[model samples]
Target: RKFWALARTGQGTTLRGNDQVNGYLLLATSCDGTLATTATPTTVRVVCNNTLTIALDGTTRAIKVPHNTRFDPQAVKKQLGIAVSQWDTFMHRMRTLSERKVQWHEAMGFFMSVVCDVPPNSKLPEVLPNERALRKVQSLYEGGGRGATLESAQGTAWGLLNAVTEYVDHERRARSTEYRMDSAWFGQGAFIKQRALQAALQLAA
Candidate 1:
């Protein structure tokens, strides 16, 4: 029997396909010692446990990795959370430091430019207190130090906020096309949490 599934629902190993059919195919392939993700009578891509082999017609293509691949949702989520948290902390630090100066708003504008994806014209000229993290924004003309160069503050906040905008755009694109809506939702949920953290940081600043 030729079995191919794109949706492994119950199986926790893969979010791309359902597990029931996968279980049957797995058993059959294991017994036959021939498992394939592609269903081509002339070309079959097979994986036997950790080992992978591709057979084209009667000819063997190559022998590669031999290990069962497993995907853990918990692990993936944890990693994503950690990554976002790091970015959030870095942004918060930059914001906090910028707020200390008399021209804090100007510095904020520069900071936003570095991190955000906002339109050039719409970016803030002043370091508008974001929720409280005073972000130091540097302009293109500004030197390496913590202050904003000659660039105005209006666009700086826009730049910082642009990061959030970029994130939202990425989420929208990812959700628009995949069958993994749950994962998509999870991604957006993380974004929301990160934004909230940034907002909280601003409030505390």
Candidate 2:
């Protein structure tokens, strides 16, 4: 069960409802009298015939690996963490905009801009999983990753931050409009009145 959950991150092949699922592929192999290397492009299912018991973080949680499993569990964990963190940061920035009633499309536009810059060839393999493959996975993420060149990485980080700042500005302007409208229409709500008064105080400061 633990293996199945963790394996989801590396799994690309999917099963459609009322459809079939392709079995795993053999991504690596070893032969006698020859140096061991990664598997060639083949249709063989990558399976772990040997059992490996690994304690994930020394907690009760552990991974059970059957033989013929070529994928590295540790590498998978690291990449998953990186990928999740990237999404988390993006979502957090978006949340700030939402709290201030900023347009949802604007937040999505910011995310799309960063996503567009990722190199196409930088994509990872669909089947075989390894450290190199994991690095490729991290590259897909907008946040920092091992594959980031010093130039590209710094630029991307700065771009995302700038987008956040722009969103904040739009949010403030949008709030000001709403506050003005509320005063002109309902002519109520002490909260709005107080907010306007505070804005005046801050502007004077």
Models 1 onward score TM values of: 0.20, 0.18
Put down candidate 1 lDDT per residue, 98-131, tens digits, no spaces: 2333245443433343244232347464544332
* Cand. 1 Cα-lDDT: 0.28
Please, what are the lDDT tens digits per residue for candidate 2 over residues 114-158? 223222235534543233422332333233322222232222332
For each candidate in the order shown, give its overall lDDT on alpha carbons.
0.28, 0.27
Off by over 4 Å in 1: 1-69, 93-205
- Report the alpha-carbon TM-score of model 1 versus the true structure: 0.20
RMSD of each: 19.8, 24.8
Residue 188 of model 2, lDDT score: 34
Choose the strongest candidate by lDDT: 1
- For model 2 the local lDDT of residue 36 reads 31
